[model samples]
Target: MLILKLTNITKEYNSRVILNDINLSCKNCEMIAIKGKSGVGKSTLLNIMAGLERATSGEYYYNEILMNDKSINSLSKFRQANVGYISQHSPMIPELTVLENICVPVWFEKDEEKKKEYMQQIESLSMLFEINNLLDKKINALSGGEIQRAGIIRSILKKPQLIIADEPTAALDDETALMILTHFNFLKSEGAIIIVVTHNDIVSKHCDKTYQLSKEGLLLIS
Candidate 1:
């Protein structure tokens, strides 16, 4: 089923156009990579999809609901419930331990039973990602790859319907990046819309489809 659709989306800064007349449609169980050189608006496109930024013009629909007109509070609630965003930068909070940082997404759950269930899932995910040993350590203690893997685990623990990952494997070595991409494939099979923004060929190659962003807009490369 189609989970996301964008029509003639345009984003600009002052007089500078970053993305112009872009159109995209994504379905469940699909992995899409947005690729571009450093100055292109790959990250900006992901941010806009994640509702962290707004386009100057055009339409965005999530699950057939119009997101362009949704209130900030409404969008925030939607994102909290259905969207998992792994940003380009480390998502870890310095004050929180590794486990605590991973649990942040479910922290607001008021239902005791659901919260307990989420915690159990978190533990399982940590073990799968091989981060169980570092759960008690501080965020500062883990290596970059460890932190990125943990961040990915955190994002997926909630089993969000749409996962927007920005440069998720940007800093990892080949082995680690492949490991993360494998997990992303698993998520895709489980019916999640995985959108990754990256410059890496390995990351893009693993995705089901790749789109390139330029001043003119998004173009399908695969």
Candidate 2:
């Protein structure tokens, strides 16, 4: 049931090593948090796993399929189908309406029935995240917290098997942060593997497991 595995992964930038010999694995429905100070390779590692960046060494496997240079296209397709990512800054399209933003992923589905199904799921997620009333509003009109919540809802609309969130709660107040984490917990109950990279202790403590990244590399902290 292991959904992700990283073995001896290393990343470098302009000859500077960022991550070194990192190995990690997580099972289906597991929740893990990655924590570190600003300069550590937390986001780098997440990007590697999500196929947004390549590791200079080692290998990755998603659902037991080897992921590497040879599998780039396949990996990208797989990620689009099964992985959802949320970054610290919500990436909603400025011109898209809230409902349109949520439905963006559904446009990739080839099946008419599946596309319609996902549209309905997006509607339900909008209500659950308390953005149903904002569905008609343009993304530029939303407050910071509202946009963040919309990002979360849009990411999960496809029910991706794995969710990677980078500093998702960093911009929110304590109450709002907790509410967002609670929504992640609810997603966990439905058997999604949630991996969050954050510097906040509050967010780290809420995860089922925690890892710390540093110049030395990744360490299991909880």
RMSD of each: 1.3, 1.4
When summed lDDT is taken over every stretch of 10 residues in candidate 2, the lowest stretch is 66-75
lDDT of 2 by residue, 1-222 (tens): 757899999988999999999999998868899988887888889888888888899988888877767467876887788788998887888888988887778777899988888888877877877888999999989989889888888788888889999999888788878988887888888888999998788988889999988877778989
lDDT for 4 (candidate 2): 89
Clashing residue pairs in candidate 1, if any? none
lDDT of 1 by residue, 1-222 (tens): 757999999888997988889999999999999988887888888888888777889999998988887788888888888888987666679888999998887879999998998999888888887899999999999999899888888888888899999888878889988888898898899999999998889999999999988776889999
Model 2, position 168, has a per-residue lDDT of 94
Candidate 1: which stretches are off by over 4 Å? Answer: none
Query: Cα deviation of 70 in candidate 2 (Å)?
Result: 3.6
